[model samples]
Target: MMRRLCWLVMILAWSTWGAAAVEREAQRPAALSVYQDLGGTLNVEQVAALPEAVFRELPERRFFHEYSHSAFWLRLQMSAEQREAHRHWLSVGDPRLSDIQVYVPDGNGWQRMQAGAAHPPESWPVVARQPLFRLQATEQVVLIRVVGDSLLVVEPLLRSDGELLAQRRAIAVADGLTLGIVLLVVPLSLVIGFIMRSSLLAAHAAAVLSYILLVCVVNGYLVHWPMLVPWTSYIRAFASLVGFVCFLGYLRVLLQVARLPSLWARLYDGVLAAYLASALWVVFVDHVQGRFLTEWVMRLAAYGLLPLTLLTAWRRGLPLVWMAWAVPLLYLLQFLARYVFQADHLPWQARQESYSISSTLPGVALLTCTLMTELYRSRARQRWAQQERSQRRLEARGRLEAAVARRTEQLRTSLDARGALLARLGQELRGPLLDIIGSARRLVAMSSSDYPQRIERNARSQLELIEDLAALSHRDELPGPSLRAGSLHAFWREMVEEAELLAARQNNRFQWRLGGNVPCEVMADFGHLRRILLNLLGNAAKFTREGSITLGLDCLERDGQRVRLRFSVEDTGIGIHPDDRVRLGQPFVRGRNVEWIDGFGLGLDIVRQLLEGMNSVLHLADDDRPGSRFSFEVCLMLAGVQDVASVEAGA
Candidate 1:
């Protein structure tokens, strides 16, 4: 009976122990947060030697994070059973990390193993994008210390050899596709860039090349391509920023941002400058700071404003609006993937297997697609336009020949076949010639108080005007710019006298509003300056009839010795219609407002060419009063009284 009781009690005790152990096993979590961050200051040896009490538990070890110029100590504990029987491999998700120091508990101390981009490639146990480390089976703690430039989101992965191999195969396939696409794009981008022969395409290629290098560096491909190792940080940061700038460039061309408000254009410029500054900082000063600057600030400015800019353009009925919205949408998705969910924290295996998408690779892929689409459409349109232009040219030539034949016939009839010179003059000065013929006939038939003298003087003036026109038509140049010290007061006074005669012929009001501060003399090409004023004033007089014509000269910029003078001619006559504004300066193109006016349509075009020779440009203004207002500036050296006296004596 005593032996039986002992046996039963032993059985009961064994059953109780088994049940308690089962309950404990069931309560333990399958996945544990084994790693702890003892912060940045602790070195591997010191950390390894520290007791468990000094470490705090990292409750959410799964949430990997990024920090600037920071170090982290991570510890993973293994049980005796795990150490004795099973071999484990550790995986790092980000290849951009500069340093990863792993320590294994050996006897009473720690054994340090270095593996990361900072170390040589051959030293690594496994040749992979995400560096893999083989952990020696031990019953003690494993600790890893890490740091990098764009070092973000390191979540240590522990797997069996089989699992690691499987992951390697999977990642190899994923990277093959991603990297393959990137490599493919390089040549295609180059070919497209050459074919397009556009700066936007060149800019796109630059952005793409930067992106390619960035991806290669991120994937630890630099382990093979050692030549690029020195530029990893610069390439990655440059990729993001340049991609943004190029996107803006595309926006500028496609949306024609210059047509947008000046404020909007200035905003684009500011963002571009900001990105360039950040890129420079990354290349020369602080890589970490630049990385964050581009990722957070530059990206926000670019992506946020890009969509709005595109949307505004679309609303204004610009082409490529679909792409404008599409590209931004892709970027928005990427932004959420990177910032909100922190998809970068996902395991490399998961990311490669498409359980999650990385931000950079996919974003670049989308951007490239959109760019190519836009370029393709543009090329197609250009080709179509060329064909249309050719067709129009052929048609225009035929019509021009017909019109010239008809004009020649009309002039021959009007002149009654009176030799070649008279017929030529008839077509050259058709409107003025008709008036001259009528006046001559009237003088012969009727007597007036002073008609004969007036007619003779008018004929002489007309002959002089024809001579001037002939000089302008001599295509060599406006007599090469003879820059010299000349008096503005004298030049304007003489020009005003001629302008009055011109204004008197049409009974138009001529007003000279010279500023009191106008310089007496300045350095300029007197011939060209005089011609410029003549053209502006002449155009004002021709376009105005029984209306006011104003000639104005003023100082725009003044220094002690140098001054910039602005000459303007404003008229109250037939104003230039908005539709004809763009056509005004083209050769042989006439403004609708000047249809009844007598001109060969070469005045404004000749004026533009003349101003260009003198390093100036013709600026047209919105005629708030009535007619067209034309203005231009000339940089002249102010001349003293002695220089004027010498010039007058020489003349």
Candidate 2:
């Protein structure tokens, strides 16, 4: 019986303790339920529970209590001045709930006031169809009413309208996207701009990007919690000031003003720096008041800089003169609307400020790019035109110089030829007359047949030399190149025969080699070709005294067309020096080694002219042994049927 009684007692004790703990937990105070702009529904019982000090501090809090049927709501009369002030306040920034409070007048005294705070399940009573509410004596509202020290404090009430909430979220998203695009475009644009060496465009793009980034940051923080709050407002104001100063600095560097007045430049830079330093202080320090109002001062200074840049560019017309006006003009309209019309709307929405500035900047940049391209093209055209004019002038001078040189050479050649001709004529007349006189004397003294023979041989040799001179004179005065068909192989054989005859006079062997499978017909000035070949053969024979001279001919086919016929004259003689090679082709310039030999230097000069007239080339072939081999190549045109017939008849 004792053991069973002990178990029963323990169970009762445990049950009693559990019940006491549950009752204690139930007696604890409920958590604070804070509300902003409660619409005429706050309970007076809950307000009466609040402490007097909490009631006095209510005005500092931001919560509004609405009274639906109060005389203050229905019969509130505002003067024109008061209404204008209210409207101006609304235009400046978003309106905030100042405070929410409850108060009960002390019975019959009104000097002593009792404040109330709203609590859970407490509703303010309605009397005479009006919601009776009392204003607190302070700015802070008592959101929580604790029975004792054990009550829990709740989070502050978040005050926001539906439109503001949505706009804040949108601004955040837009700022993120803008930052992303800037990150991508900024680095790439900077690299490309640096590579291209376009400092103005680079600096402009960077400054614009930085400005955009600043706007995004400011707008994002602003649309959320920090915009209207006094501390954050001051910080943002200062940040904007810094951005403005940075923009002006970038503009100054990009414009590259070297000759601005020293006093003005230093003053402008100093002011910008001062504003920027003030902005930095605001960012770091708290409780820097008047942030929203001070924004105006910075904006005024910022806008003033634009006009200064414009006046400077206008006066100087320095680098990118159009940019000074273009950028400022686009910004000017929007700036005026902000200060004059007080358009402090957000940047993303299509309100007055946003829409105007949004379209203006891109348009200005594109226009500047277009103008720059046009200027570059215009400068290029001008340079090209000038170069063309200069080239034409140089060509005219060159032609005049060539004509003068040709006339002077011709006059010199005429004088030399005349002198030689006169000397030859004197010799010819003296010899012939002496011979005829001797023949007559012989005849008078019973002369023999030998004297007559001697006279005939001398007369024949003199006649042959005169005929050669006459042919040379005629060749020198030949007509322009007239194309005609002729036998290529037959012409070669004639030159070879003439060369062999000349070689026989010098007791030197002569050899000829000819190669071509075609009909060996060509259209050319035959007289010029004949003279060129004769000169080549004569030079070969005149130089080679003991060894053999060889003449070679071949017709070449290029690209399925008869292009050229080549002639080579090789002689076993003292080879020409490398330095004298070009000199041999000049008129009146005999090779040094050939000065002891016979003949004037006119042969090769005349040969070069004839070859040039036929559009041919003469080259000294590189035999490089103990002898010289000079070769000639001429382009040949196809012969017509009538030309072939004439060529065959001439052959």
Candidate 3:
């Protein structure tokens, strides 16, 4: 009897322990699994009809498929205790999912609940940051249908209302802090960039703002706002595309890519353009294809081009280029672990909130540090530039002062030279005036024919001197000669008469020679021609005493209506000295050997000025004869007989 009682007591105790263990197990949340509907045609009835074996148990608490067109069906089997609690809620953690339909068992029917970006929060069965469905007391199974246009990540959880509220409160505080920091940092960066006028800073700020916006979209912060709900579908794609583009721009500026080789700069620009096109494609075209292309392009830029450019910049001696590798390296590790290696079991992958914060915060910090370092370098460069500019200004001031002093000295020397020239000119004029006065007094006392001629010659010399002075003073404003057709023979006869008078004063024999080919009627400026020849013949006559002077004309060439003629004057007088050649053709300047001659040195200067106006040159030839030979060539238009008649008739 004692053995039987011991056996029964042990059985009852073992049964009680097993029942308590069963009760504890019943209170725990149900295990969730997923079914991929490749055709996306499965309804709740069809999914329910399918065998449980067709569904695969999800290995991680949260499942991630970057982007997919296929629909996913999630099945959750609730424990008896969870069903009886009447407070358990089934939550789909991603708010950006395009469509989420939860079918909760109610009595014999299924209570369908809709929530997600597609449905407004007001119509949701239970409004929250993400989709939520209240579990019925008698519910045993919950079916969730999910469809997404962007990155598809689903984390389904079964928890009581109190637990969910507590978890959300914690998330809200963390999100608030993150958003506050973003708001503070974004505007601060912009203000600083504007103040400094730094493109690098502005690009960095743009990148930060865009990336934070992407994070907000991914983490479902924007979808909760009523105004933002309409854009929830496309916001993720837009943010991602814009973020990558902005990041590339930031890198381009940071690496000083414009300063790089043309090939590298072009490559960076192509990548930037591709990213921008992708962004526009997402907004205006098909979002799914756009996002797919964007991902591929972003990967190419971030993984291939970006790293190579960084390496190139580092090799090319860009300062702090190595520091820019931190963000990319961090991103590479995160990408490899999350996507390539399928490290979804990690603690960070439990919630996108944590994952986004973890992935982005470090990159933001690294980029910020790199930018700050660049900012310091930029400030240093500005300082160096300022110092260089100041030094250049001082050098320019010194040069300007020296130039001003040199110009002042030059003006002073010119003024002194002009004063001496004026004194000499006055002395020359006084001698001529005194000669005229003495000749006039002699004519008045004796009434001799020689006194009249002597007085007339002195008066002519004074008049010539005054005329030369006037021509020199108005040399800059002189008009070119007016050309007209006239008889060359008649013109020369008049000129010869004047030349004979000049030659007679010095007892010099004057001879004239004209070429046989010389045209009778030719276009010529008569006034200028007369002045030029008379000056040459008079100079010859003055310099020669009882010496023969010859005036010669030759027709060099004739082409149709134009005739090229050369004129020459030769005198048997003192020739030009070698030392005086360089100093000739200057106003108020006389040859050293000609100081004893009674004349001012304005003849050659006037001849040069007049010839320049006529597009001709005065030439002094080396001669075997005792005197100088002056020659010049001019082209004249041949005129008809009627033209000469008209000219004579007009005269």
Candidate 4:
């Protein structure tokens, strides 16, 4: 009886102690003050049950050397004694965490709520820009694990419903402002680029877009786009490369880097290519090696860019370009101090402020200002050129008017001699006609004797070839392309045979091919088509020396009864520039790249006129290589079987 009574007393004493411990936990603050581990590979149970004595022993050092593989763990506590449950939330400092796992208190075990950079925003417990988790103050213990691919840092804070709302409102305002700025600048930059045809402006705009996207990623807003979040690492890695490429391209144009000596320009191009290759590596391969290669390339590029370009442009009086160096300076500084040296020993709040979106602001602003200055300068130059052109036009008009008045006066004075002039002109014309008849009679007399038959044959061929030249010279008065039923392939074959003959005369190699199984017959103008091909081939041969000329014909598109025939003439000669292509079809306007080649530039003009007559259009592609290519497409009605006989006769 005495032993039983002792056991009952021991049980009653243990129950009383347990009740007192529960009461102390209930009295704790509603907000979680501090967490336990900063960096480790610990799981939720390991963290939650960690002895109080163990946490008190370690000093807080947020920066660890093995940050890439380490995980950050935080312990949160709340009283389960509340009269009514209230909404609470957890906030993480860094936005680029690769993984986030939250452990909430359950009946017997912990309940896990998961999120990460790779996860969609909607899947998160609380869908905010950064990782946010909904909570109730009734939970006993909550734990969070943060993982990152690179250096990982953790900053956790518990907030009430009111605090979260206020924070969200502030974030909304900042986001709106940022998006508004981006929206306004993108279109404006595009418009300026279009108006001035400045590649620098276009590149600047692309850089801005890349900058915004990078910001979205580093700030965790990219989670909103579920499809894109999966490529978070690639996107983050590519952002720096894209920005650098665009910025460098802008500088290349604005600073006239291409004006450097050929050897130096080639070196510069090679460096850019290396950087691009590294960037591509990062996108398609391992980010770790890619990041290293890209960083080294950027560092080496800095040597060429900083003193050579930034300082050089400043010396040449570009203030905006000079001011733009701040970005690189800050980036280098941040890299050297925080990333390279592993100097991120400060608390989470300070580190977040040091290397986030706020750091890129000044550089972004400087770039914008520089682009704006360039835009204004472009407009000013355009206006000045316009004024100068107008002044020259007026002067030319005045000179032309004076010349016309003087000529009119001369004509009026010469009216008295006009009758004699006409009589002399008619006499001269009659003499030429009589001479032609006399020469023919003499040639006939000689033909019966010893005149060379070759001379007569050559003379007849020259007359026939001159007939087409005569028709081309009178293109304005001549009729359009005469459409008729003909075997398109046979006609093209004949033209190719003729082109081979022409190319042979010029000692140029000629190649012609028909694409696929082309329709045997097409409703085409044999006469005009022959003229077009002959002109194109003749020009190709004239320009090409010890080189090749290629003629290609293919049916590009087909409808019910009509097919679009695509034709191309590519020649191993000096290629055309994009700028010169605009005036290519104008009579007597040769491409600047044509150099010393002898051409009145009438060949392409005639071809364009003929194609237009056939209701076709001409298209200039990138269209340039070690040589040049001129291409056109024409829609023609397909010929039926009955047209074959007529086609044979026409050919």
Q: Which should have the higher TM-score, number 3 or number 4?
A: 3
> CA shift at 582, candidate 1, in angstroms?
57
Which one wins on lDDT?
3
Displacement of residue 158 (Cα, Å) in model 4 is 0.8
Better of 2 and 4 by TM-score: 4
Per-residue lDDT value at 172 in model 3: 58
- The residue ranges of model 4 lying beyond 4 angstroms of the native Cα positions read 1-42, 47-67, 77-87, 105-108, 118-123, 262-296, 299-304, 311-364, 401-651
Residue-level lDDT of model 2, residues 332-392, one tens digit each, is: 7657665566555534222322312232245324433533554465578789999999999
lDDT of 3 by residue, 474-567 (tens): 3432347788989999887766766777888888998989898888899988767776787788789888899988998899999789999998
Quote model 1's TM-score: 0.49
For model 2, the superposed segments whose C-alpha errors exceed 4 Å read 1-173, 184-192, 212-246, 253-256, 259-263, 276-297, 315-323, 345-475, 478-541, 548-601, 604-651
Question: What TM-score quantifies how close candidate 3 is to the native fold?
Answer: 0.53
| TM-score per candidate | 0.49, 0.44, 0.53, 0.49
Score each candidate by Cα lDDT. Answer: 0.66, 0.51, 0.74, 0.65
* Sequence-dependent TM-score of model 2: 0.44
lDDT of 1 at 345: 51
